[model samples]
Target: MKQNLIADYLSCILFRITGFFTCFLPFNISLFMGRRLGDLIYIFDRKHRVVACANIRKTVAEGGDWRAATRITRKAYQAFGQNLIEISFIPRINKPYLEKYINIVNKDNIEAAFKRGKGVIFLAVHAGDWELSNIICANLGFPFILFVRDQGFPRLNRLLNSYRLKQGAKIIYKQAGPRQLIETVNKNQAIGMTMDQGGRHGELVKFFGREASMSTGAVKLALKYDCSIIPTFYTRVKGPYIKVILDQVYTVSRSGEAQKDLRDNLQRLAGIYEKYIRLYPHEYLWTYKIWKYGKERELLILSDGKTGHLRQSESAAKLIIQQLAGRGIKTNLSIQEVRSRESRQGLISFKPDIIISAGSSISALNYRLARQSQAKSIVLMRPSNLSLKKFDLVIIPEHDNPPARKNVVVTSGALNLIDADYLKEKSERLKRSGFIKSALSPLCIGVLIGGNSKGFSISGRLISTVICEIKRSAEELNADILLSTSRRTSPEVEQVIKNELGGYGRCKLLVISNEHNNPDVVGAILGFSSIVISSPESISMVSEAASAGKYVMVF
Candidate 1:
């Protein structure tokens, strides 16, 4: 508390010094200095610069280009600097200052609203020159009250509110409860309140295609008191010149359902602000995390187009989706197939909360996209080219010799979609499709054949020997066999399997993957088999067999 008091005191002293000079300086010169100050801040304030750019990318640039978002961020900083300078010059604003630099459009809208006799609620957002609204309304002969909460810095808050009061505007503390507000409305007066940056307790509504918390205070007050709501906006025409636009009075709905009425009205009001922010991209504040508390999440999968890698990525994405769903959050998934090193397109507006990739080839792309969207990066395997510390989480097989690190998780084998429920579902589907014989013996063995790899190869003679042993065992035990080949199976090896077991009555199902494909074949094979035999060339196949809790042998 002591530290905060000292900081606030220093800030108040700085504000006083700035106000003393700005009050005397010409308006245009003050604005020019403010822009330069903003430029300096953009260069030095790395944290906020990144945050602002990320926000712009998600909304204004629609996640298309970082350079465009950076440009807008730079300009937004300058506009905010100018806004700060104008705030200090509030003491200098008078009738002549309003006439000279400020232009009011649709001044009669407030008049029309006032004629309703219930009072007017000036609905505004944190956009261009919002501080000037109260002064402008005061000068225009409107009975305006600035309803505001006390800021953290008491000294600076007092100084700022003093300036507002000096400009002929009445003040109403937000903590003073609804009685004061009710009194103000009963007097047929107007109260100005900003509706954006609703903080933690605000209502969740859709804004810029994403849900953001927005204040429903204005809408609620207008509804309860039967007041007119005017959607007000301020735009910078040029340096020191601003246009105050009063949109058509927002008609508050009385649907009789209280919560529905509140949300619907607030969402419509937020849409109005989104439209203007889209038009004047650089004028609005973009440094804050607009969707931080939102319940919606986006998940991106970076695929290298390899079947095994894609399947692993899908498994990770499924887990994440399930976890978020358990917490009552909605998730949207997008898959981008990375064909080349330069393949980074078509992710135009998706801002992901988590980015997942499987293979080494697409890890770099995953990192880049995660950094751009400010999302968490998760790689299934240890990234070959990038450091493990760069990713938020790295899952690598124990055989890969993964190092001990906080971010690294060592798994026994490759990730595959082969849980008990998944196996049961696929098995039932195969039985319904007549692929599995209903009259077959309960004792069964599953054979999964894989082909060439970097360190291993499958020969026709070797597969024939393996199939003969399997046939002998099947006949001795009176058991049925389910057999399938992989995409890598050579035609010679496939022909050997067909010759050995194709017409055998004990061989219940035989699949030549090179000729026919069944996505559920592997899972269905593992579903009901008493034992599983897999080729040593594919770790993914072996892993699936092991995960099925069946006895497995690798040939």
Candidate 2:
């Protein structure tokens, strides 16, 4: 608390000093200095600069270009600087000052709204020389009541409010609540309030193709009291000269259902402002997290078309979705099978919060896409060509000898979709398909055969010996066997296994991968078997068996 107070005091002192000089300087010179001040802020304020760029990327750029977002953010900073300096010149905003610098378009709209005998609600967003709006409205002979939230710095807030009060505008604190607002409306006066940055308790509506929380207070009051809502916007025509546009009065829809009516009106109001922001993005405020409390997120998965790698990416995506669900967030999942690095045209417009990929083939694509979209990248297994630091998280097997890094996570084996529910579901499907006989032996042994790997190959003789030993053990223990071959199995070894145990009574299930493939075979084998014998070639296969709690034997 002490630290915050000291910082606030220092900030107030700095603002006062700047204001004193700005008040005496010429309008154009003040604007030039303010722009320089903003440029300095853009260079030094790393935190808000990042926030601004991220906001621009997500909304205006549509997650396409970082350079464009940066340029716009820099200009936005300059505009904000000019706006801050203009606030100090508020005392000079008289009739001649208004005529010289301010141009009010559709000035008759205010008259028409008051002619309705219901109060007027001036709905505005945090955009373009907004501090001078009430003064301009008061100078135009409109009864403007500035309904404002108190700032944390008490002295600064009082200082700013005094300027508004001196311009024939009445003040209504937000905390003073409904009574004064009702009175202001009863007298058919106009109340100015902003609808952006609603904070936690706001209505969720779609803005820039994403759900953003927006304040519904303006819409709610307009609906309940039959007030005319004039969507007001300010644009800097040039240095120190602004155009105040009073948009067409919003026609409130009365559906009699309060909640639906409130949301629909708010969405329409947001749409009006979004259109303007798209046209003049540099004039709008982009320093805050626009979607911070948003409840929706998009997840993109880049697949290499290999079964093992795709499954690992899917597993990671599943865990992420679960975690997001716990936070009351909904996730939209999209899978892109990347055949080549150039196969990324479809992902250009997708704005994802996270991008997940596995296998070396898609790692480069993942890195590039994450950089383009500004999403967090997660890679499974150590990427062959890319540095580990490139990804936000790296999941590697312990056998790979992963380095000790903050982003590196070494797991015991490869990731797989093996769980009790998954096993049970696959097992039931296999049983229903008549792959598992009812009269089968109670004890079951599963055999998983994989083919060649780096510097390793399975010979036909080795398979013959393995099958003979398995036959002898099955006869002694009265156990049934479930066997499946991988897609990489050699034809010589596959034929040897068929000749050895094809029609044997103990060998109830035999799947030849080249002839036909059953997606559920492996999971079903792990689901029912007590002992599992797997070739040492595949880490993914062995990991799946061990994860199922089966006694695994490697040959």
Candidate 3:
């Protein structure tokens, strides 16, 4: 603890000296020295350099190239250095210096906004000498309130605040709460706030196709007070010259739904930020962890090669995401289809909050991945080779009749992907594709046949009987038949069923696996059919058919 004080004092002295040198030197000379210092820091500051490179990789288009990421990371450090040196010159800036070195485009925007007397909310981000913005505004003789967050070091925060105050700007620390902001706005003073920083108490918005938490305070204030929010940014134009772009002003709706208004307004601000960042990618703060929340909450999906298992895992993941949305917990989901242990190697890089999968083929892999990543494993079926304790959550079908345990969740049938919305969507798509004989078929019968599986066998006579019964039943009910077979269906059984249903004009579709394996056939039939019939062999197929919420008959 005693060493901390000595180190802090030394750090303060170093900062003061750096400030003195930056202020004392000529603009161009100071910039060159700052860039050199940045290059030196890029070599020395290992942790921040790594972070900056990673962030650049996440945000840029060709981010996968290490060379590209490295170059950008170095430039990002240099930008930071240049910004710091310019901040040291804030006290020297005045109206005359601004006229020579600073150019504020679209000044008429703020001038017109001031005529309304509603207190404009200036939305800006941490990009390109942002400190100069407040000073320039104050030097323009506008009453401005700058809202700033407390820095890590109290002495440095004080020093920074003193510079802003000296430029005729009112400082409002974030911890002072909304009362100060309300009073300032009531006095018809412009408020400047940076909206891109991650906050625990804010809405999750997409910044660059990835979810990042954004502060909604500006949006809320704009909506509540009917204020105009002008999206603004400051960018460096060559040596010692700054260009401040004041974008078009936007007004938020008083939609009476506060949550939605807040989200939409924040989304608009985030969109503007994304645009400028794309324009000046290196000028933004790339070292900051913009996707910290997304990285923390990941949902990993492990899939066996079977279509049934993959569908089950994906459907359960969608449901989990839906539930999390209700509680305001945004999640990042990744699905991987694994055929062997080698396919699991990629899981080493991602640490998930929960790992989910279905079928016995992927149970062991799921457990291994969950243990390695320290995530909760959720198995969708009864595992044949592993103990129940190995999984954090085991969802078993009632037919298995597994022993009761704290971690076990017994479901009526297997979890399936046949939800009402999916059924409606696929059915409409198939109707438009001319696959369905009649989109408005009032009595379409679906036949889902499966072949040999655990304790079950398919025979020619059984196929004949099933086909005869289906034809007889369809005739009695005056229904159109849509029949399909699974991968497990035997060729001989398929032939028998086809022969039995020969010359039946009412059989609208017959998707024999031996001929063509159209993946959408089964889903389309299940979605559009009024009734479904399944051969009792594969539980997954039967469960999915029943989940369509039609009258399902077991043959």
Q: Which ten residues in a row have the lowest lDDT in candidate 3?
A: 57-66
Query: Residue 62's C-alpha lDDT in candidate 2?
Result: 48
Please identify model 1 stretches exceeding 4 Å from their true place: 1-10, 23-25, 340-343, 398-415, 428-441, 451-465, 487-516, 537-539
TM-score of each: 0.89, 0.82, 0.58
Q: What is the lDDT for 104 in model 3?
A: 86
User: lDDT per prediction?
Assistant: 0.86, 0.87, 0.80
Expressed as tens digits, the lDDT of each residue in 372-405 for candidate 3 is: 4446799998986899998989988899897899
What's the true lDDT of residue 510 in model 2? 91
Candidate 1 vs candidate 3, TM-score winner: 1
For candidate 1, the lDDT comes to 0.86
**Top TM-score: which candidate number?**
1
Would you list the clashing residue pairs of candidate 1? none
lDDT of 2 by residue, 354-468 (tens): 9999988778888887765557899998887889999999999999999999999899998888999999999889888886645567899999999987899999999999999
Candidate scoring better on TM-score of 1 and 2: 1
Comparing 2 with 3 on lDDT, the higher-scoring candidate is 2
Return the candidate ranking by TM-score, descending: 1, 2, 3
Q: Every model's Cα RMSD, please?
A: 3.1, 4.3, 9.2
Instruction: TM-score for candidate 1, please give it.
Output: 0.89
